[model samples]
Target: MVEAALFDLGGVIVVGPWEGFATYERENGLPEGLIRRINSTDSDTNAWARMERGEIGLEEFAAAFEGEALALGYRVDGMAVLNGLSGELRPEVAEAVRRCSERLKTGLLTNNYSPMASSERSAELAEVMGWFDVVVESSVLGVRKPDPAFYTMACEALDVAPSACVFLDDLGVNLKPARAMGMTTIKVVDPDEALAELEAVVGFSLRG
Candidate 1:
C-alpha cells in the first residue's frame, strides 16, 4: 500500500509559470524556449542549479545565467525569467493535499531557492505548507530533484520505502529518479488527470 504522497510545488500544486515565460518571450521577441534551452544546457552545473542548491544568490545567478545565454548566442534577460516565476495556486490541488495528509504521509518536494525575504511567502502559501507532513526544499537541502539523495531524504522523513510511496511532478526528468527508486511516479500535465492517477494509485478520491 502507498504510505505517502509526495508532490512538487511549482508545477504540481500551483499553476506552472510556463505561460509567464511565453508572455515574456513574446514581449521580448526572443525565440520560443530560449530560457529553457539555457536551463537545460549543462543543467547540473548551470546557474539555475547553483541557485536552487543555495550556492548562489539571485543576483549572482542572474549574472551567471546571462553568461550562459551569451554562450548560447542569445541575449536572454535572466532577471526577467526570474520575475516570471510567480505561479497562482490551484485550489483543487490544495484540497487534494489536505485530503492526502489525512490518510497518508504527505510531502512537498520542490527545487526552489530560499525566499530572499519573509514577505515572499503569503498567507495562502503558509496554509498550504501546513497540509504537508514534510516539506523538502532543494535550497535548504543542498540537493535538488533527479538527485537520488533528494528523494531518499523525503522518503526517510516520511518513514516510508520508495515502493510504498507515490510522487507527482511536472517534469519527467524530476520524476525519473523517483520512479527508478520504486516509487509510483505521475507526470503531471493536467492537474485533474494527475489527481485521477493519484486516486487510482492510493485508492482514494482526491478531487471534490
Candidate 2:
C-alpha cells in the first residue's frame, strides 16, 4: 500500500557529519558535542536553522553561530564546524533509492544550506539526486524537518497521501511528525538494518 519512499539525504542516504564533528572537537580541544549543544539549544531559532532556511548567507551564519557558541561559554569556530557537514555518499542507500524509483515514488527530503557558490555542487551528487521523483530542500522551501509543513510539502510534491508513504530519517525528531501524519517511519541507525526494514515494508529487495 506504500506508494512512495521518502528519504533524508544526510545520515540516512549518505554518511553523516558526526564523525567530522568529533574530529573537529578533538583537534580544537573543545568539549565534546559542544557544537551540537549550541545548535540544539535554540534549535528553531538558531543560526544553523536560519542558514538551512536560506534566511542568511554562509558568512553571516559563521558569525552568528560563533556568537551563539560564545554565549554558551564555548569559543567554537563556526566555520570549522560547518566544514563537518560534508560526507561521502553511501552506495547501499543510493542503490535502494534506485530500486525504489523503479516501482514507487521516491522523494529526497533534505534540510540543507545553500551552497556558497553554484560550483560547490558535484557531478556525482547531481546524478544521485536524479534518482528521486521529487526533491524538497529546506533551503528552497524556507521550512525544515520537525516542521510538519516540510513533510507535507514533500508528500504534496510527490502527489501522494501521507498514509501511503514510508519515511526514513536518522533523527527521531524529524520522523515524529511524519509518523503522526500516518506515514510509516523508519529510523536509520545502521544502514543494513534500515534497509532490511525497508525491504519488509516495500516488499522488495533494496540490496543486491
Candidate 3:
C-alpha cells in the first residue's frame, strides 16, 4: 500500500508551453530542431541544470542561457523564452493532487529553475502548491529529477520509504529513475488515465 504521493510540476500538474521551441524558432528564423541540436551538443553546459541546482542566480542563469541561444543563431529575449515555456495549471491533475493531499501525505518533485519564484505567473501556481505536504523544488534543493539524490531527498523529507511512495512524472526519463529507486511510478500522458492509474494503486477515486 502506498503511504505517500509525489508529483512532478511541469507536464503533470500543469500543461507546459508546447510552443516554446517553435516560438523561439519562428522568432529567430532557425531551422527546425536547432534547439534539440543545441541540447544534444552540450548536455551540461546550459543554465537549466545549474539554475535548478541553485548553483547560479537567476540573472546569471538568464544571461548564460541567452548567450547560448545567441551562439545557436537565436537572438531572442531570454525572459520571453522562459515565460513561454510555462503555462496554466492542469485542473484535472490539480484536483487529483488536492484530493490526494487531503487523504494522504503528498509532495511535489519538479525540475525547475530559480526564476520560477519571481515570475508573476507563478503566483497562480502557488495556490495549488499550498495543498501539498512537501514541495521538493529543484531550484531550492539543488537537485533535479532523474537523479537518485533528488528522489532520495524527497523520500527523506516525506518520511516515507521509496517503496511506499507513488510518484507521478510526465517524463519517462524522470520516472525511470524513480521506479529504479523502488517508488511506484506513473507516466502521465493523459490526466484522466493518470488519475485512474493512481486510483487503482491507492484504492480511492481522485476524480471527484
Candidate 2 weakest lDDT stretch, 10 residues? 114-123
State model 1's lDDT.
0.89
TM-score, cand. 2: 0.96
Ranked by lDDT, the better of candidates 2 and 3 is: 2
**lDDT by candidate, in order shown:** 0.89, 0.89, 0.80
Tell me the TM-score of model 1: 0.96
Q: For candidate 2, lDDT tens digit of each residue in 1-208?
A: 9999999988998788788888998998888888778878889999999999999998999999989978878787788888788888888998999999999999999899973224265667777788898889889899999899999999889999999999999999999999999999999999999999999999989998
User: Worst 10-residue stretch by lDDT in candidate 3?
Assistant: 36-45
Off by over 4 Å in 1: 115-119
Question: How many backbone collisions does model 1 have?
Answer: 0
Superior candidate under lDDT, 1 versus 3: 1
Clash total of candidate 2:
0
* TM-score per candidate: 0.96, 0.96, 0.86
